[model samples]
Target: MLSLFLFQISLNRMIKTLSATNYSIEIGPLTESSFQDLLTNKYAHSRKVIMVDENTHDNCLEFLLTAFDDLTDAEVILLPAGEENKVMEVCFQVWNALSDYGIGRNDLVINLGGGVVTDMGGFIAAVFKRGVDFVNIPTSLLGMVDASIGGKTGIDLGAFKNQLGVFKDPVAIFIDPSFLHSLPENEVWNGFAEILKHSLIADSSLWAKIKNYRNIDDLYTADLIEAGISIKLKTLLNDPFEKGERKLLNFGHTIGHAIEGCMLETDSPVSHGHAVAIGLLLESQLSNNRGILSNEEFKEIEETIKALYSPIELDEEQIAIVLELMKNDKKNSEGKIKGILIHSIGHCTFDEVFEEEEIRKIL
Candidate 1:
């Protein structure tokens, strides 16, 4: 059904289930029975709705339909693809569709696409009629490792990333790595950016191993996927919400989101992963200048990231725009711009207010 096997590890060897406070994530080597049986048993009586974007509609929706007959009657909602589509207008339209379908709180929504689908669909289910149970069937590498795993569901407000949203977990998340084949190379790198961030913030050994890879191919193994998932899970254990330790996950995201907004204004828009890759390097440098990260470590971080990703060249105007947006980032308090920084690889510090001048020094 899905090439049977996509990686070196066989079905059984790859790690299986992981749980957070209320939900569980079922990683690769999934079977029709593993997915279908649960749906038939648990959701037989619930109205089914499967939401996806244009790409997932063409690439992934059929695979899911063929695998699970339980979804035969599921209402399919197809959203327009791309970051720009992740807006309140789209959400409002989806809401109207839900109303048209007669969907209610007792129903179930299967978010069957990449990050955008899971993020926006979860938001739709959460706020619709006070809340509807939803599940994530992440079909992108980024979706599998980061977006779908966390309870953060949101849409962009203009160009700002995740500007409007909620922190509501899906009932379950089904991550089948077979879907990796459906992605273009750029899409794969987008997810790798988040996974790379994970290694830096909490897993030094993982980051060390990651740097040794000469080809991006080496990064796409089930072993690494499971390991990355575990690192993100570790944070959820102590801080399910972004109340404390979970903020570490937002390290590269602050500047990354701002960079993302800047590119959307240009001719060639940047993908989330591309923007985050750039943000990681800049923030790592910011950490160094702020005296939190060591000089040698910053060089290593810069070298490793630059080798894999082309650095973004922001013009003077764009730099000012990015700095202004950083001041208004969600992580900031009152008026100070704050973000996570690694004092050492695999370790980080937060609640550090970065002065505008300090940020300008790095930019």
Candidate 2:
């Protein structure tokens, strides 16, 4: 009887492992068998290429290889890790790698790292042969919830972040939360920033859940990925092409992207989430100033973000540069600056453009 009980427990563990591969986020939980299923069923006969960075290669290459075991032939591409590395130069590197791999239109590429890997790889796949299918196997929290789920793929152009990219959804995305255990503390914090943003935009319940997240360990659990992905998917399903109300996803991204550009101009670039953390606070203040967001709600946002990240002071000069970046933001229409602002939890709207002078004072 005891032997039978042990066998049942082992079978259940295997079943749990198999169940993780169907996730939409990047770093949820994936197993070797699930990957095989994707390759054999959904993407059979599709040439495969996996893109990664140095750190991700060191950390996850072995597991990735096991996932691709059935593939007799595959290609691997590597890039430098960090926000600074997500650029045209790296894009060119991927282009070259794809060329060498002979990746064709029918082929599929797998991005196997954090946001940088997935974002750049997805962009290459989108443009390669005028577009091909791609998949995401994100290894970081930020990549899982934000970058991997949305069809928003691109590389940073010059000092501008995400200035060059496209919105091409992948054939499939698999998240394995096991990867989060390997992430650095700061990287984990970076991902939490996006999770918090999701909650603020459309799911007050999720915001409340994240508010109580005590540390990195809390985010690695399956519950965080499940809740975060559900919120993001709901938003994208409503705005797949980002043509309308979906702009709510930019809650903190408006100023965050600009701040990212500012830091990129300097030698040190901020993580996407770190920059967005500052953006969230500043934008919350903007919402309050506009009288849409209540001061108390703004205070809640400020306290929540500050609980996890330290404030980065931006001087007048820095603010000027960020404004320039915002002027070129993709959401801007024919040179008019537009922003997505929040009025309350689960409430957001776009089409309000902030004046350069006005933003300067806010800075």
Candidate 3:
């Protein structure tokens, strides 16, 4: 399910924490009664850096700054928003600012924005001064459910998605759903794609809830958000480095990332979630072709996705381009693209290799 909580404060909905391999994900409001005091007391004397994009700086940062007095003296580094800005050049600029601010290993780096901010901010903290403690306050649903949870920090290389990255868990992850208010309607649905991905790969119950909702407003609850995080975290803790089962999470990402890369220079680029939605359709069809998923289940998956996401018709030329981009996917090994094939809506197999010809046939 594309589970989301409403913007209004729910007094009865107590704060929830989801455990990861090392760090804990806190889903709740920023208040003195919650985990706020623990954070303030822990880093009261340490130098702090709050990394944000323009959107979060203007919208979410104030709420955080107001709630935590420990960050009163923290430096704010604002970068231009969007995936295009997540690059080496921006990292260099942020590195220079950190140097100028006299930040050191003991200081904390708080990433405060969407996926781009969390991905790149975590990377900066990992590389600077050989490694530093940092926390994530993901302001977007994408960051909250997937990007900010896995400890996989990355930045795009040229048009490729997450081509350069490091595996470094943040000190903690605080997800305050109130930040969703700053997002446009499209951006919110973009995150919905990941939730959909999680549901298809592991949680049939979530999928059952997801397929029933024709409107985004129908799904709003924090516990469902925790369920999505728990699904990803369980697989990640078992395989932190993607040596095995973690590949299950990459179900739609293989082709989805290629589509994202191919559209990078286009007049209109597709969002990550939309791109993944397309990949899900293609891969599930392949599962049926390979005699894994049942045709009945495949039709259900297709109908549910088509109801929410418009089909992105790719031309022969565009298909050729994405095919080439898929060749560069990190999961590819032995000169074949790697993908996860599903047995059904909630179960999948990992490290299923496909020859270029087989993948081409599907395209």
lDDT of 1 by residue, 1-363 (tens): 001111222355453767554666777655632566558777878899999999999998998888677788899999999888888999899999999999988889999898889999999898899889999988888989999887889988876778888888888888888888878877887788888899999989988888656565765676777888888887766677687888899888888989898788688888888888888998898888778899988888888788877778888999898888887788999788988888998998777777888777777
lDDT of 3 by residue, 251-342 (tens): 88888888888887787788888888888988998889988999999999889888888877678888899889988889888887888898
Tell me the tens digit of each residue's lDDT in model 2 across 49-166. 8788998989988777875665547777878988788888778777877888788998878888999899888898899889988888888999877788767898887767788888
Candidate 1 local lDDT, residue 69: 76
Residue clash pairs of candidate 3: 1-206
Question: What's model 1's lDDT at 314?
Answer: 84
The TM-score between candidate 1 and the true structure equals 0.93
Sorted by TM-score (best first), the order is: 1, 3, 2
TM-score of every prediction relative to native: 0.93, 0.89, 0.93
lDDT of 1: 0.83
TM-score of model 3 vs. true structure = 0.93
Q: Which model is ahead, 1 or 2, in terms of lDDT?
A: 1
Off by over 4 Å in 2: 1-28, 41-44
